[model samples]
Target: MKLSLFLVSTAGLWVAANANSVNNKQTKNDVCTHPFVDINGRCLFVNNFAQMDWDAARAFCAGFQGDLVTLDEANLLADIVDFIYKEGLTDRSYWIGGSAGAQTGAFVWPDGSLVRMGTPCWGVLDNIQRPGAEPNEKCIALNKDNFFFFDNFNCEGEISVICEYKFQRENRWAEGGCATMKSSAVFVFLAAALLGSDGATEAGSHVKTDVCTHPFVDINGRCLFVNNFAQMDWDAARDFCAGFQGDLVTLDEANLLADIVEFISKEGLTERSYWIGGSDRALEGEWTWTDGSSVRMGTPTWGANGQNQQPTGGSEENCVGLDNANFFFFNDFPCVTAMSLICELKL
Candidate 1:
């Protein structure tokens, strides 16, 4: 009797432990609040099963933290279907990530244009082409009712959707080290707004001295100062700025202008003819900034239309200057005179 009682106690304990383990797993899977299944390193979600239209299904995916499936990798898609199966998702038709929405002869994911193409397979047999396959349908749909058969459906037709967000490894900086990523560099600039361009000058002086004054901080970029009083052709000024990892200074916003002015004031550049942003390479009659942005600043320093007037003969003037007056517009100048420029780079 004692032996039987001991055996029964052991069995009861094992059952209790097994039940607890199962409950823990269930809780873990249920933790995701978004309509998604976390698998491998991505979050996957499927939209409701309804025949609405492609656009509607896309919007639904956007709402649920993903987009219509653009399966670049075959294994990933298989994993997704397995998840759907476990969840008892019986959506007969589902939209996926293949579309020729932008142009013919090419397929692109609606999510982003940067995704690279990978092995294409569909359904149980992993066949890209099948009998009666309408390759020109432009959009693909998975028919779950027919055991996940792939179909080329009209883009206008509505169906369910699946979304996936790949996991990104956040780069954490070591202690005492600054953020090193490009995005982090932008954030650092925003946080401090430290003055200065990424300009530099090599030491040619024979005298050993700490006599030079720094008008701005390096912030991992360089800065160059041009005396406004000095007359320089547009080309020379551009070359000068280019030598320092910058282009001819173009002021698109008031705050940017203010920053330049602050730097100039610190550098004691009070009365020089600095180069302004103007280029006419693309369209001889039209003016554009160095970055190809539109030159929309009103009331240029060289006077309105003063820099843009078409002269009687020489090659269309392609450069401009900022006079002591109307500071925004460019005054036409030749391209080869040496002038000051500001260089910039993300720290």
Candidate 2:
């Protein structure tokens, strides 16, 4: 019997809950680095934090000595989605390696494998031409806006990235021999490679940058921003942050609660509530951050409700916010309630 792992020549694919838990059928020995987890024989990095354009996304992956992930394997999509959801990328799309810009109508991966297009692979659309027929939407993406299935997206659209690394580097990259790029992205990747030849910036830049940019305040060691001006509902607040490649703030750090509260208080902003990205909308009372991390409850985190406790509103208050009524500690509130927001930029 020929040895194979995760390479399925079939149309049907299953959605897995964890990348490592998938039935990827192969002998294992390859160990991936931090952030890149081993799935079958492949090392995959699901970059849910930083959002970049398709070309920039590929370049970012190249920084890690990898390339934008290729979904040639049937079970890989399932595994990738499993990792994405686990990372709390339920609201973001992702740029992959496949593009039809090379052949116009034909889509292929960096490895020259034909980009699969079908029901379980591509999301439902009027005309499913795999890499899509739209001239503008040449880059392939697992679009979160369109049910996390393959969708041809605009090359310039900024979204998340799924980087793939291999022990045998010959499987990917433009220099591997065959011409795989869609068009200008090929040159972009080469330029980035040439620029990185001197090794000034390491591949670790994929996760988090050292310094926070404008609008994002550097608090102690973290990057955060308080939108004390615009009042929006919980959903709208999150979407607003998404535009900035960020999301609603999560008081994850020990000193974040005290520092941020004090900062906003000095701005005279704590007098009004601010959305802070904790919600039990998926499951009532099970509060979690957008990335699926459990929100640390009680103690100095959540506020009190009279003689009871905060989060007293139950399902009606699925969304969480920093309430001034409770001295700016955490409090559950209706998701529709308009409140100014606190954003955390991952980029």
Candidate 3:
């Protein structure tokens, strides 16, 4: 009955561009890691069974390596509403990412991007926002009773969290729309051709044969091994790579970074986030690889959550990993979090 009611209110939904609304239709980029579902190119984790206050909800989502879902686009909001109704979820208030805590009346996502205001985004009654006080409140959510439009509620109010994982596809091929959803095999081939990769080696090729024979399938390129089977914390993951005469993977060339990401995404190895070799443990913000080389920061290298930059976690997240949410772009994660890893050693 909820979705049925929402379908008739479609005219109220308008399109606004944001990280999660890049695609018009529902298409999955990578397989949603268990407990998440593909919704219009976003891997969403919906927990209607648990309820927590605004702050607690944020911490809960972070445990899953995601932030609260931001519904910047009208269509995405509509899709989520329909999804809840169809999935037989209870018609109750849900927590979203926007917050006015920093500055009252101005809502922003976790990455500090201003939450789009007005319109089909907010519920209106007689052409006026249902609750005039909502805009000045601290946290934002989809008011289920208000036809699922953005509404501000007190931060302490208990509610279910709907988080969105920020998955990015920043490969150079995207300039021509290559990132657009397509068959896995076709996309992989196109990416390989454009980036000069052959998918030549499998994950199991970490064994050595001769002086010229190495575990990786390469001639002179980086000897890298993707560990898709085991998951471990940052230190343990690094030790595993050490046993193979390698450390966590590090990137110095932009093109090589692109190739590795494409290989992982296309080859279906995105089920979990990966531990790379960059960490700021010695000095906060001084990111360096295991060999003590500096790690690159900023666009095309570090991924973003909406408008929020990567490595924004500050002191809490000292280790860097290729986040699945950012399409393998570098993301700062807590060292304690368990994940798969990439091992690299020069041949």
Candidate 4:
């Protein structure tokens, strides 16, 4: 009878262990579902059920406790594009978190970070178009038709959306219904638990460090030097930057421009015009950066109105300078015209 009791007890223990294993597996699976796909440690949801305008699409993502996906890294964006292609979505455009806001051409993420422009971030001619002669395209979308290269579109235009939320290990639970919990609240709790009271990492925590040379301020992962020493013409300014193993600053992204503006304001240099690295000297009406990338013209890049507007001097003005007269909006000026300069170097 004792032997029989021992066998039954062992059987019960085994069954309990099996049930626990099954519960754990189910909890893992429940962390993500349907539209939400696990990608590079983040949970991303592609919503194609309804087409909505940019504002509406943003609201929809917010309702799910997520925001429109912001692609700061090129590799991350490529991964998302690949995921979309694998899912057989090759004909739809999905709204992302980039927009020019009140100032056109200065594209920024929803969180106010600069969206890297040109090359891999933007689609080729076939995939992206400016829509009209005017600078009215304020919103950005991922074009599946063009391999998911980002394209600027009208904000009012209806389109699908992609939402993103961070995935935390502690949030996974079989019986806690964590999937229905608000993402913001989960993030707060997780951050507190992981970071602890001191807000410093514990011993053996991995950290990343970056350093910049003297006189060059680190701005959004880039080293920038605003030359306050002297004012010179565009050609001389280019030579000045070349001396320091850099080039005249290229305001390719909106946030970069905003940072420069803020810096100027802080330094009391609001009235000084600065020479930037954009010119149409090679081909009239075709503005290109020092790196030979074509410039996305209009709106924030140009002055808001009146005589301060861009390319105002026509062929006579071949170089671009950030004019303080019109709140630092770029204006085409003669290459020989004297102005302060801004330089940039990659970290």
lDDT of each: 0.43, 0.62, 0.61, 0.60
> For residues 1-347, could you state the per-residue lDDT of candidate 4 as single tens digits?
00011112321221011111101223344444434555544556676657899999888877767788776654456455655655555567999888885755577777665665543355444223222233667888886544465677888989888886533223532111101112221110112111212222212221112433545554533556787668898989988887766688777654456456656766787768999999999999999988788775543345433223257778899998887765675778989998899886532
Task: Order the numbered candidates by TM-score, best leading.
Answer: 4, 2, 3, 1
Model 1 lDDT per residue over 5-105, tens place = 11123212210111111113222333333444444334455544445677777776666555776554433444445545645566557787666556443
TM-score of 2: 0.42
lDDT of 2 by residue, 42-101 (tens): 677666668899889888888878899876643456455655655556787888888874
Model 3, 131-231: lDDT tens digits are: 35643358887776555556778889998878766552112122111122222312211112112222333333322222212333321245566778899
Using lDDT as the measure, what is the rank order of every candidate, best first?
2, 3, 4, 1
Off by over 4 Å in 2: 1-19, 24-29, 126-131, 168-347
- Top lDDT model: 2
* Positional deviation of residue 312's Cα in model 1 after best superposition, in angstroms: 85
Candidate 4: lDDT of 265?
69
Residue 99 lDDT in candidate 2: 81
- Candidate 2, lDDT over the whole model: 0.62
Evaluate residue 264 in candidate 2 and report its C-alpha lDDT on the 0 to 100 scale.
72
Candidate 2 clash pair list: none
Q: What TM-score would you give candidate 1 relative to the actual structure?
A: 0.34
Cα miss at 13, model 4 (Å)?
58
